[model samples]
Target chain A: MTASPPQTGGPWRATGTVAALVVGGLGLALLGLLLGRADVSVLGAPLVLGLVWAALTRPTEPGEVVVEGAHQDPDSARVRASVRLEPPAGSELALLRVGSPSHRTVDVAVAAPRSRTVGVSVSGVRTGRQRFFSVVHRETSVGQVVGTAAIRAGPVTLTVLPRTRPLGHLPLPPRLQGLTGSHDSRRVGDGGDLHDIAPFTPGDRLRRIDWRVTLRESGRGARPGSLTDLHVRRSLATADAVVTLVLDSRDDIGRDISTWSGYAELHPEEATSLDIAREAAASIAKAYLEAGDRVGVVDLGHHHRPLRPAGGRRHLLRVMHTLATATPSGRARPVVRPPQVPSGALLIVFSTFLDDQASGLAATWCRHGHRVLAVDVLPPLDRGRATTGERNVYRVVDIARADRLWELERAGVETVAWHELAGDERTLAIGLAARARQRSRPR
Target chain B: MSVADRARRASASARVALFAERLVATARIWSPSKSRPLPRVVADIGPWVPVWLVTAVTAGVAVASAAIVTRGTVPWAIVLATIAITVAQPDGPGAGIFAVTIGVLLVASGTEPFAWPLYVLLATVHLVVVLSALTSGLPRRARFELALLVAPGRRFLAVQAVAQPLALLGAVVTGAGVTLPWLPVAAGLGLVVLAWRLDVRVGDDGDG
Candidate 1:
């Protein structure tokens, strides 16, 4: 449905009204002077009144203008708007504005009722909910009479998300597999393993006590029998491993894109690059939870996203909630107050991998005994698309960043260069699994 | 008048005078139209030029304007001659320009016959003021360029001697003759800076 006409107090209408008043007053004054010598006092007032009435009671006809929205480019985070004005039947419309500083206006002309549409395009918008409040139409006859109308379009919004990349054959963290070497089930229960014998406490299981020792001890003396049965026992109970995602948030975001040529494209509801990283980190948390491994999220963006290192469904959900709500500020330098990290916690940092600060923060986490994984969100360079200056700048920044990366590498931060869509949990989980496999080798 | 009355009167007059002086200084520093030292150059030229050039231009303009009003029109020949010497000596463009303008004016009309001989002393005075105000020395780049002039390279000295004075002569003559409205000079300098910036991207196609 078309919008109602705008209230006629805007700059254009004000100018129109002023022009009408000036012309009318001057014409009336001229008429009064021409008829000055005659008895024309009564006629003069009527003449002035008629002009004023005509100027004030000018009729405004209504019309419609369609405002079209679309993503102008795959890489651009902006939406473009094209406004087309369609006037009434048998009218020609001109001087139409879809959106003004205050209100949009259109001026049109009609020859026995004819109608037409005019279109204008605006570009170079950033990410947000953009609104086109009203379409303004002003119709002017060849006789210099002007009428105005407005068509309101929308409270439309465009969500621009970061571009995604494909994940293929990327490996998971090493320690993701269950604790090994301490409990091999095929070796047999207490066969070449120690079966424990202890003083029979109140809640001691009767199955584990040695019957002959207990009987002999009870017969020999009234003292409580120390239940020590000589049998092999498993020394290692099920040891829990925790995964903590340390996300970096201080880098400048790259250009946004919704799809990378597939159905499983990046979602635009995600706000920032950090939000994408949060989502990826949460996905990893989900995987670790499914693997029956304990998982928790340490939102480097949040001081309280939990560094407790506990894992379960509840813990995974906590991580997801933290990811959904945490806002990433642009302070990329490693914070002075280090996160309270549990020992042997795996820290996976999901990042765009475009800036040095993120890598630096990951390195800091690695130094503190956290197994760090750096996921890159940038695609492989498409040289044909980049300009010479852009390529040169990219090379310089890349080289400098490479030096930092080498430092992180030396510090034992497991650096993974996974493009945006390339960072599904399978790739991360496999990477962890490979590390686990390598660690489990017979060294 | 009584001593008490006189003291009160003196205090009131002193306060009024102090207020008047503050107003005058504020007006001088803040007016965009007024050609004060630092803001004048910035408003005219964008900030890419070395800060020393700004200081030099400021001092050079101040001293040259003072010399012109004190000493009438100097000849173009002597200014050109000084420019030749300064450029030949590898003098900085600013110093050379200032020397030439003052030198020519002295030589031509012979009004300030002393201006030519006093060029080195004026520059030295300006240099001291500049160093003191900056609270350090001139930046490395400016110092390096200035050192080239003082060094005993005959060709360098010759170029400095010629180019500097010629530039100074041109600046003064043009500044006085054609740029009657001083605002136009600022606009012209801005245009020149723009042209230089536009030229910088021409040869380098990101090759470096």
Candidate 2:
């Protein structure tokens, strides 16, 4: 996309080197004449020649700078800027400077055109729109004469999606739906795994009858059951899982409490809790969606930018794009009411849990019979150098926060600290293994 | 030694170590690390003060010194001052004028014929003016690129490689009262023009 309108060419201006040569030459010539020093006069020849050469070759036309690849992925976008000179004959060197308010400025120099591209790698430090404001191009001649032009391409805006980390198997909701899926349903239906055996009833499929069990029962005793009472194997049905991710975007606190005083002015390099929450939510959504489970997103603070439950690669992209656009709404209150999630769908709520609002929402969802997983996204606190009074205050706040989490656990809402779950492959593996063992054990 | 005396010595050494640590910290704050790149150095310096103002002041001092040594006429001083001001401006086309004026002032002073000290000082002043002019008002990000671009050019300007010996040889010949012919000067000028024309032609071909 065009960043800004291209600037028209301007007149060439003499650089310092050109000025030095001219001034030095003229001064020496005058001194030689007054002092009758032929050797002194002879020294000015090179300077005079340089001046004449500069005059002969001064650029008559200004150079044009065209920037391409201005739009970049914040995570891995490399911006390339190119300047194409109109009559590239007189120019010796060209320098281009690119800058944005949020990022460090970069300058690239290319020897006279045959236009070459200067590439700059940028880190995706923050989410939302990033704009590059100034781009200046300066060209110099062999005589050191400088010609400069400023090109204001339309500001290139790159929307940086929040980065995601690899997540292990996520907890499945207690209930499942639909006939076709990966997870086994407890009820008997047509499936791969046998559930139990019982006497065949009316409308039972002939193929389902267990011939071995029927023959064994017939030879059991004098009171053996008749053929009408044949046993049939029952299989558990497998159904798909639906997951709803709730993002608490009210507060974004970093590790340093003092830095939080100017929360809005914090640099993008310093990620806050909201950043972690977005990342966690994105990771969880990706893991489930990759597993063929339908995943949806709910922004607790922003009513807009919600994605409906769906499953596919395209749906994952939509969910990630929505997650990247998430910003803290700066609301002091919790969500007025728990968001509506589909029945039997697992609800994953990402929050810092600094206040009771997020925990209350998770508990509410749990009360409504939906399985809720509350993720504490707060960064670890560093209290190493704090004063006694400050430490006491922090202690009190930590205690209160811990009590809220305990209450969530008491209400049957499973709470997981993001730091504890982050990159912990064994936790999910062990949990899944235990769940499998439980399912296989005889009742 | 007594126990008290030993304890006092230990305390004194500890205080010295503490002072040394503080001194090093202060030094680090004032002096940038050598390994830092040009752009970082420019950013640390922060903000621009017009280069011309600084160049003007330095050039004025150089001119005043030349006047004192030459006992020159007021008109001569005026001419020198004007050249100095022009050279000081990074954008002005007065570098040749400034160099010529310095040479004339040196000759008029009639000090030792090949005064190496005077040449060295004048060269230093010229170097300062050129550097100030090139770097002033340049954006911080551009400073690193400018540094890279100017390296070869600066090497070309290091007059010691060719100009210093030529100037000394000419001074010695002139001191011996031998009148030089114009043929060599004419030939040199001809070669310069030929090189310039050749460069222009090559540039034109490249453009095509």
The model with the greatest TM-score is 2
Please identify model 1 stretches exceeding 4 Å from their true place. Answer: A1-240, A255-279, A289-334, A352-356, A383-385, A420-425, A432-443, B1-208
The candidates' DockQ values read: 0.01, 0.18
lDDT (0 to 1) per candidate:
0.41, 0.60
Per-residue alpha-carbon lDDT of model 2 for B80-124, expressed as tens digits?
Answer: 665555544445544444555556556556655444434343344
Expressed as tens digits, the lDDT of each residue in A190-253 for candidate 2 is 8879899999998889999999989888878577665535889989988779999998877767
Worst 10 residues of 2 chain B by lDDT: B37-46
Off by over 4 Å in 2: A1-11, A15-18, A36-39, A66-89, A93-114, A124-137, A140-142, A149-155, A198-209, A218-231, A263-267, A329-334, A383-400, A422-443, B1-98, B109-208
Give a tens-digit lDDT track for model 1, residues A59-140: 3445454544433345543334444445443232233334422122322111112332233323322232233324443443
Q: What is the lDDT of candidate 1?
A: 0.41
RMSD of 2: 10.2
